[model samples]
Target chain A: MPRFTAGDRVTVLDLGKPGHVRIPWFIRHKTGRIERYCGAYPNPEDLAFGRPGLPAIDLYRVHFPQTELWPDYPGPPGDTLEIEVYDHWLEPAEPLT
Target chain B: MTPEPIGYSADAVDPSRLVVEGHEGADYYALMTEAIHKILLEKQVLAPSDTDRVIAALEAPNVTWGARIVAQAWKDPSYKARLLADGSAAAREMGYAIKEAKLVVVENTSSLHNIIVCTLCSCYPRSLLGQPPWWYISKNYRARTVREPRAVLAEFGVAIPPPMEVRVHDSNADMRYLVLPKAPADAAERRFDDLVRIVTRNMMIGTELVEPYRDRG
Candidate 1:
């Protein structure tokens, strides 16, 4: 079962480890909503090195408002960027006011 | 001052001619792909037929069938609902051979506009849309679209003004996506066939919008 459901808030974590990672730097340390759970899959970081990655991790599409991600974001607050984030990269975030 | 040599103009040797022929932008990645393929073949990890089959899949005629789905969704509300609920299943039911990646179909509305990009690399819905265009894989597009989509869409000749929100999908992992462009407001005035014909590949990729269909007759 996934930890977060659609509409839940999440903060993409910046683990700071160096290696193959699916999460982009732009999305790191950002708050977003769970768009949808994309099902579980072997950690790509492990798969990159030919490891078995036996235990799969859940992946969810997180939607972040452009204004929060960028300081000078010119678009409307509704403008969002959605990306797939693994369970490990996401943590529960407090609801935004 | 001496006159120019026989049949020779001063611009004949214009520094441009010295530029090497056939080596313009990116040859390194091509070399890297060939090297990796060679190793895979040597290790027996990839069969020659496998490469051929993959190439065939990429070049197949049924590649850009997103328009078909778009057209069907426009005509049938039920189908559209099914597509939104499970895009991969709906596309597969329609006969699109989805590879390992799943498809997520996003629709455009008067209040929202969607654009697609892969910030880390070029991951596209090739099974449904054939191959992504050159710009789709270019480093500039991969880097810029998620940063400022409206400006990028404008560069792609689309203008999203006011209350209309721009949503960018980063197709970076596991899932591929297709944009279901909203039909024109005057769609009822046009024939279904022409509208389908104009549903276009770029519109499905979210870079362009379908123009109002006009009768040729």
Candidate 2:
């Protein structure tokens, strides 16, 4: 079972694979708020090779402010960036340093 | 089998200097038909005689659940919020199963705008939506939309004001996206059907916004 839910804060981990990963390249090291919970899905790595019935993974709809994702995002101050991510790609956010 | 004579020999003179690729032979069509038949059989949705009918039906455009949700959102704010908050539940309320297609909704607000793209492939919500536009799958659009969103929108004649910001939503996972555009001015009081007419498919994808049409009379 997934630990995160909508509105939960989490940090995405950096999986050091060289080839294409479904998680956006820009978002690997960012932290965001979960906005929605997409139900269990087959892990992309397993599905890529036609493997069926792969282990179910949690999908979270995360929201990051536009400014956080891009250096030059020109939206209003409160604007947010939202995206769906799988479980393995994220970990609980560390306490503020 | 011996290699068949090359249809377009390099030595042959050609007009217009364009190279025409060889066409698929009869065997290719027969194999394709058989493959389709096997798929239909596995799905157990139709009889062998009904294959032609199914083919015709597939060719015809059908109203999809995604379009239905957009239409409903135009009429009800509560439903729209549900859609933005929890797409699966919102779709379930309208009698659509989330399992049918992975559905996601991107909200367009006063400060931030959203657009959808399937950068890797045309991974659209077909069960909830019919096929995507030919342009949606074009390599040009996929590669360029994320990096140069404003320019792409400009090409589509959509200009973003200085105060407004654009965000490109990449639908690369099994999940698909629908652009929930901000309702046009005075749209709240409009009838549902009239609003649907104004919110064309292009507008739903964020390439255009609903503009009030002038009355001819």
In terms of TM-score, the best-performing candidate is 1
Give lDDT tens digits, candidate 1, residues A48-77. 999976699998999989988887887778
**DockQ for all models:** 0.25, 0.09
Residue A87 C-alpha lDDT in model 2: 86
**Model 1 alpha-carbon miss at residue B178, Å:** 0.4
- Clashing residue pairs for model 2: A64-A81
Cα lDDT tens digits for candidate 2, B67-120: 667778877889998998777778789887655456778777666677887766
> TM-score of every model?
0.82, 0.69
Query: What tens-digit string does per-residue lDDT give for candidate 1 at B14-126?
Result: 42233232335568988999999999999999999999997897788353377778877887789899998989999877787678588899999877888889877678887
Listed per model in order, the count of residue pairs whose N, CA or C atoms clash below 3 Å is 0, 1
True contacts kept of each: 0.56, 0.03
Question: Candidate 1, residue A15: CA error in Å?
Answer: 0.8
By summed lDDT, which 10 consecutive residues of candidate 2 chain B come out lowest?
A: B7-16
Docking class of 2: incorrect
Best by lDDT: 1
